[model samples]
Target: MVDQVTSILKEYSVHTDNKMNEIVESRKRVGHLYDMMKYHLGWMDENFNLSRASGGKQLRSTMCLLSCEAISGDFNKALPAAAGLELIHNFSLIHDDIEDGDEKRRHRDTLWKVWGVPQAINTGDAMDVIANIAILSLEDTVKPKVLVSIMKVFNDMVIRLCEGQYLDMDFQTREEVTVDEYIEMISGKTAALIEASTGIGAMIATEDADIIDRFKTFGFKIGIAFQIQDDILGIWGDPATTGKSAKNDIRNKKKSLPVLYAMQTSAEKEELKNLYRKETLTEDDISRIYDILTAAGSLEYTQSMANRYKDEAMSRLEGLYPGSEPMKKLHEIGKFLVERDY
Candidate 1:
């Protein structure tokens, strides 16, 4: 189903791919640094060998181009922005893997693990700079005034993304993180980028702020729902499919939505709390936490919240581009985000 939704993006793949390659190749003076970026992007390996390391689903870039097409805009004109959004998304992921001490991504060693943290941080920063450069290239494709406005939106989103990451790391140390706080954190950490992708797409495609706002709203709501489902997958998804243990997030003591909900509503809150405080959790302790989470109905609660957000996203999409093929594609993507199990 997601493949169906993403098929609309097939048209823009070459454009975005070319832009990504160009961005990485632009800094030939820092060849080694760009090699790291390419490695992380799965274009090459740590030894610069050609291998098929998955570079993720490129969801942000697809949404950007789709949002542009939804407004009857030429997706080719939006290619730079699409590439920019993907770069920013990957930039965040590179840093996030470091912050989370994640050793692997896509079943390969993370950039930070392969390169030291300092070098990995440099590569992430380079990706961000490349992202900004990519967005600025839109000046040739869009009106100068419009490009400036889009840059403002892009810059503002960068700050929010960092703030959200800050809050996420902060939650790990604090004993309590309310559901509301978790929502706010994810709004910045995850949803903001998605919103920017859709919002920038609409911004480039049309001059109507109203339509742009609608796209932003649609992306934001669906992004929240997407992240919530990811949280669920972090806990209960099959490791074979997800490529990580179901208990991975729990072992890291991530304050995911389900855990927060369970902490607030579970009768065994104290036990769960004590379990979290421990430096290490035994297998039995992980099972107990799962039991408590289930007993508290946390999974259902999280899914209900995700469904509510998806409903809102669909409503916004309807208003944004009624009965259009692009709208249908966007709607299907939203459904896939919520419905994907792995």
Candidate 2:
């Protein structure tokens, strides 16, 4: 069903682009700025090849569509919200790579890497503006009162995203990050958009208060599980699916879930502390940190926590809607979010 959803999402992606032009298009005057937005969307690239990695997976858009249908609402009514999440997510990614000094995104050079940080920052800002514009299309698709309420929800989520990013950047230098802190950070940085994707989709579909809360709780829990799983894979999962080895996160001094778990457990917190305290971490030190993190069972611990969240999410989902094909797809995809290496 995820594959089927992905199929619909690709169709929606093209359609969303066409709809966006209705708002963003001006003559050749602002073409360069428009092209920058397109470039980040994988419509244009530095090498000028259309070929790119699976551009964003469109998972959020697909979720919006599915939830809309499942909740007994018209799927087309949710298109603006679907496109909104996609733009919001891509905006976050563009800035995330720039802030992390990451050179690659989806198997291609990140905008910051190819174009430089200053322009990359501007480009991400532009994408965010586009995201806001995308949501306004709801004015046409939804009732006026409903549109205002949903737009407020979308705006609030974006603010939370910034808070998450703020904490993530702060974690870089902080020596005493906890597992709890990691959860909060990901909730803002990674989970907010995801939660909104599912929640807003439900809003477009149904007016039941209980059902909306169900979708919110479900998306929130799954989002945490997804990031924890990603962090674990970043440290110990296979490289082919993850694009980063089990050792990559440590090499970058990332304060991910497992790393935080290991930090407080070891009597040698001092040792772990010293390794990360260095100005420049060597390749050799990264190997040693991985060994310590492994010995501390950080990967296993993180995986266990992911399972707990997935269970919680599934339970909430079970209450909202009964067993059905779409629900099964949601269940499968939700579990896969945590269990899969990629």
Query: Each model's C-alpha lDDT?
Result: 0.88, 0.78
RMSD of each: 1.6, 2.6
Q: How do the predictions measure up, each by TM-score?
A: 0.95, 0.90
Clash pairs, candidate 1, are none
Tens digits of lDDT, candidate 1, 256-324: 999999999899999999999999898899898989999999989999999999999878867565688
The 10-residue segment of model 1 with minimum total lDDT is: 5-14
Residues 110-192 of candidate 2: C-alpha lDDT, one tens digit per residue = 88877788988887888788788888778876787877878888988999999999999998868788888888899998888
- Residue 169, model 2, lDDT: 91
Worst 10 residues of 2 by lDDT: 22-31
